[model samples]
Target: MVGILLQPQSSPFPLLFLAAVSPPLLPALGVFSLIIILMAVTIGDRLIVRGMNRFRVWLTPWFKSQPSPWLELSWSLLQWGLRLGLWLLGVIGVLLLPASNPLQRWLLLTFTPVVNRLTSLLVTPLFTLGKATITLTSLFTLIVVSLALLLLSRWLRNWIKQRVLTRLGLDRGNQEAIAGVIGYLFTALGIIIVLQTIGIDLSSLAVLAGVLGIGLGFAFQQLASNFISGLTLLVEQPIKVGDFIEVDGLLGTVEKISIRSTVLRTNDNLCVIVPNNRFLERNVVNWSYANPQSRIHLPIGVAFGSDTVLVTEALLAAARQDARVLSHPAPSVWFKRFGDSAYEFELLVWIDEPKDFEPIKSSLNFLVEQELSYRGIEIPFPQRELRVRHTEELRLLFNQPTSPAPTSPQRPSQPPIPPPQAVQSSFSAPGQFAQDQTLRVLLRKVAYFANCSDAELRVLIERGYQKFFRSGQVIFRANQPGDTFYIILSGSVEVLSEGQWSPNQAETPPLAVSIDPKATFIQVENQVLATLSKGDFFGEISLLTGAPRSATVRAVEDTILFVVDRNALQKLLQEYQELAERIAIELAQRQQVLRELGLLNQEDESNPADKTPLQRIRQRLQTLFSLSDRPGWPGHA
Candidate 1:
């Protein structure tokens, strides 16, 4: 390497010093100062970041109601574009320095040869064709042009859909279709023009295109099919947005149809993304297609000998009473068949909104029951006449001493239902049948509910809901609303009266001044009368009368319970007609106990002498559930 002789003649200052300070030295300083000032203004407090944030804030409100993908893309482009412009300005500043300056010389020396070599390599042809030659520059140009076109296509598509088509008042599907078609046209034409501008002959690329096409055909076959299907959906408009449809056994409203997939919002508020092709391939049920009216079937069964005419009239009245049931179609009743233990009929009512079907059916059930009860038509359970040829096993199960054969060989005419044995077992109160089985199975096994059919039991299950309670959660407090009742399905609960004060906790009253630690404290809590576990059921009597509860029930641990509210309880009582009186008697006794213990709320003070608890409860039940009227009982004046 040879050392260059000092050129003091070129500049008054040393060449190295001149290089460090840069050239046209006085002017260079001024330019650098200007650049420094710009950089300081741009970088201080992160000017770029703050500007972006301010832009986002300003743009947010304009598109607050709906998201804008085009805005997001444009914002990204602006950010990158600003950075590129700043960098270009910096490079121009450096290149503007005097050539004799070492800094400028060094930069030129380092990059000029590489730049020249690269230009030669990139501009030279990699392959020559009859009409065009392919070079690195052309390939690079194609890639960059494709990317630019991609962005342009997206931006245009979104603009047309959101700005142009929307103003035309066209439907969303039509808007999407138009936008997509425009986008495809732009993309196709853009690629053709770019290829021709770059001197790439379309004819020369045919064989290569064919090979690529075969490979791409296999790779994106489903993608292409789904895209085509999406286009067809937008054009045909078989299932429009907001139309309720069932496809692939999934029921929902159409949310959006994109290029490849369609979105559906289900009744549960879940968004399901289904491929567009599925709509074309599978059978779709559009309930809200043209006519918004649809018929719903409510099956009714009553005691075998009930009058069909009254049944029909009751059903018709129930249907007409509800505003939701359309009158134009006219509700019709069809006698389906003679059920094993009852007459099976279907109540067909036309409804306008299928989405409200569940609620409509539920309300109609209450009305139907009211109408049937008004006419005293019993909706009886399927009576399974038990033929016990041998009573020995049942007798042993009840732990009864084997009794001698019945005197005089009495004919068993639907042997009178046995009373539930008053459970004297310490597990329950003095006279209560301990619920030791599940609600459904208990209904089947218990003697009081023996008349209930499987269908009626199923109704009980459908009506009640299961609830979970953490340890120490109070299920019900004494004197709270007694409309709800609980049946322990998987855990234990404590039943306490309103009640004996057990000293389980203590708290001192705060004084005017700081209280001493030794201050006297008093605490009184409910006495835990009993701990009842799984299969335990309570609150039936309280639900019947809607009276104040006489006891508090608390969960002993993490527990699951089947809870039935007033309406369901009323229905259950109505189905088990014979058990209602017994439940009333039980409630009366519990109320007496509460009164004696001085736990009764003053609001609950009653003249017990005028009406027996049983009579009061029955009358209350009649008013609450529209049960059949019965003749005066023993205490009814």
Candidate 2:
């Protein structure tokens, strides 16, 4: 080959060929080659430096007085320069190939010439304006498209979050996760399109994709499972936000659901994070799943001797009366078990909503206590009886007579009974009657006597007698003629009606009402009105009835009573007709109020009602005063 090249040709073909192609191409090709190298070095360095600077400046704020616009401009310039430089380098690299490489040379000659012509045609007009109009137009278009895309993405996200997810009742956590997923999907598509526009080939991506898939599968198995589970949860909706659930013994309200986990806020203000897969595997109690008609089971126990029927009725009444309790499915009481000292009963009541369960349960407990107390059903405490050998001293101390002994003459010589004037003055002194003000105040508080003046109340107190009785002491007997009304001052008293009465048989025997000091007990005819306590009063009703006692009263403990004699009341009525009339009216009004309040039983009585002397006088006054044409009494009219 070397010898053939050294030998001279007979024809002039080599020289002619050199002259035709080589001379025209040498300078142009050399100039193009140098331009290519210069552009590559300069543009490539500019792009790399600009990109690094933009990133550094964007990420670090320490060097800038004002940074936001600078950072954005720098980033935009970096992206534009990098893309433009890459295009220029590609065109230059193609043009630099030698003519010996026929395929590459032809391609460059054909396509590069057309590309250069188009570039010259496009660039000449833009440069004639003395500005980078093309670059500016491109940047503006990019900015506008970016802004439009950003706004469109934001609007779409908001629509999905509010209109879509909210309608589905998805939590914010789930909404954010879904929005992120959508953004990532759109970003991936945008990147592929951008790569294609930059003349990058994706034909080689299949192998890369296979490798990525295998790597991702190995690295993110749990993540993949959770993501799939989250999609399933969204589709199936096994549990939702705001659901009260019990999972693995953790009872709480579901606060959020995300791709990886679910968050629950417990009743005690604890936040519990449960894995999505774990939630799918565990058993959950959804309190509000089908309906929020939650049933409350209240367990009540009463003393062994209590009347179960009465207890059941009272409990049912209590449940019915409560507004929170549902009425359609009526309340039920079952005798649960017999315990050591009490009969246990379960009171089952239904509520309309799950959220109301706690409040209803609370109100029911309060009502149960009140009802049991009012009906005299004993709620026994845990108690044990201990037997002990009693010594003589113990017996003597316990059995000692509680009543005060009379003053003995041997102790001190007593003065003659003081004159009525001295007695009255001594009793009315501030020191002598200071403690009596409490009793005076208590008497005024009695609802039946609330209308009485302070002076009249004091007179009543002055006339009242204090009596004490030990436990088991009989204050009065059943069927005995009612002589006087007794007010309990301290301790408790039991009311016993004759066992022969059928209605009374169903009621627990010897119904006791606790009577602390300052309580008044009244002996009324034909009815056991009430067993009174401190700040309680009675016996005005007795003035309405002129018959004998209906039930016996016995002291359940050491009890003190403030008793108002019937005869004293009769005298007081005679002296003050106006006061008596006012008292009578007050009593009647109180009874009417009690009946309206549902505190008194609704029943008809067979006994004949008697008109008090004050009532009759009031009738005469009304007749005399006569506002109507018929001159009828006020009540009679």
Candidate 3:
């Protein structure tokens, strides 16, 4: 080449100048150009892919519906194939550059032999085994196949866990177990298939396996133990997913169980990992194993002088107040022992949700404290003592003169306690429960419920809510939809409206009163239309007729009212058909009284059909409660 350049014409200035700059760099420069071309092709491929991805949302509208999984996967493979083809095309374009371009011609000449030599090397056999030979291509195939097998196994496991086993009505543990077993089987079979396809003789790998096995056995002994324990957990079905388990004083819900470890989500929302073998080896307390309900014992200590009976009552009251405490089990107080400074007692209560252990225990403690304080039962505190060697020194300290302590101001005297007999007044009937006796007696005063049996009244009491109303608390307001019926058990309530009574009226309210037509229900006047006391009831009119409340009723004092809502009345009317007619009659009487007071329209006089209001109320009750379909209802078939 140098001799030709010495002659005249073959573009000596370009090649000669290039060589003159750096003689050794000339060949290396061609290699660099080749590398630059390959980099450009790779960068362009990525840029094209990015551009296509950016337009994916717009392209999605072109398809009528979403592509299936296989179609989507094929599309992904096609994109990679296109990228590879672009690289090949880039190399070909460089190779096809005309001979006139000196740089392109030099690159072609320099890289062609190198590419051929690499190809020869790839095809050359590294070793021959019986009929099977190993080469670079075969090794590359083996690596690709191994990676493909792993990916396929993972995908199969996920698919079975999510789609197949999930729909088969299996629990999460069973699903995970089945999927994991299938995945292992599939991976093993896949390896065998790949090895056979790549022409690898399994018999020739025995010695290699023995060597690897010798090393792995000692290295992975603990790992093997954990794996076996995990498999045992999956098979034996001890603690499952979502089980509330306590191991070594650490309590949490089981979230995941893998071959190596188990994930436990604690009450504080912390995820902890414990080795699988630890669960098998250690004693585990499963709170939510076969049954989630478990008994919780609360150890309580009261001051020594406190009444044991009163302390028991307070503890029982606290447990009864808590709805989480199971009623059938009936919480009991056990007198455990007489401690040094306190009497030890254990409150044995059963609850249905063991996962709520901490919260339920805390709530019970709060309730116990409140009940003990209410009954003036003192909770015991730990006693601390200090010993001094000199008795004369302690006496001298006590006898020392000190400034007189200023007297602390006393708290205002508490309201006088009501007598126990005051609570068990004429409002109670024979054989009535102590807690709800007054309510049952009050309920009996209502004409419609006079004949209710003990069991029926108990049902009604269970269904209705016993709510407390402080003085000045508005029970219901006029023109509001009347959904609740009230039966006063112990205190009094006044029925009034947003109007002034006529001046000429006597102790009785006048038939007409002056009132603003647009006035809201909150503005009740000083005039009280009626003062209802113990065993008296109100809200029956609206409850029966489905009309808005005619007047507002509020507590005259701190009152306990047995409140039965419209749904309870509806159910009661359906079950006791006779009660509906009696209630209709009661509504008529109330409406008549309203008419006499000029609150209701005066001329309903029944004109001549004096039963109009009663019939209207009955029709409304039937419509509101759908009682016409009830079997024993008179209005129905």
Query: Best-fitting candidate, measured by lDDT?
Result: 3
Model 3, span 272-363: residue lDDT tens? 99999999899999998887889999999999887665576568768877888886545767889999889999988889888897898999
* Candidate 1: segments with Cα more than 4 A from true spot: 1-28, 35-37, 40-78, 97-101, 117-169, 203-206, 316-325, 356-382, 388-637
lDDT (Cα, tens digit) per residue for candidate 2, span 394-479: 88899888988788767666789989888866753322222332455566565545666655554554445566788879877765
Off by over 4 Å in 2: 1-222, 267-272, 385-637
Error of 3 at 490 (Å): 9.5
Error of 3 at 625 (Å): 39
Listed in order, each prediction's TM-score against the native is 0.50, 0.35, 0.50
Task: Supply the TM-score for candidate 2.
Answer: 0.35
How displaced is residue 489 in candidate 2, in Å? 32
TM-score: the better of candidates 2 and 3? 3
Which digits, one per residue and each the tens of the lDDT, describe model 1 over residues 54-122? 866754543313444554554555555565465455545545656325556766888899999999999
> Candidates' lDDT values, in order?
0.69, 0.59, 0.71
Instruction: Give the winner by TM-score.
Output: 1
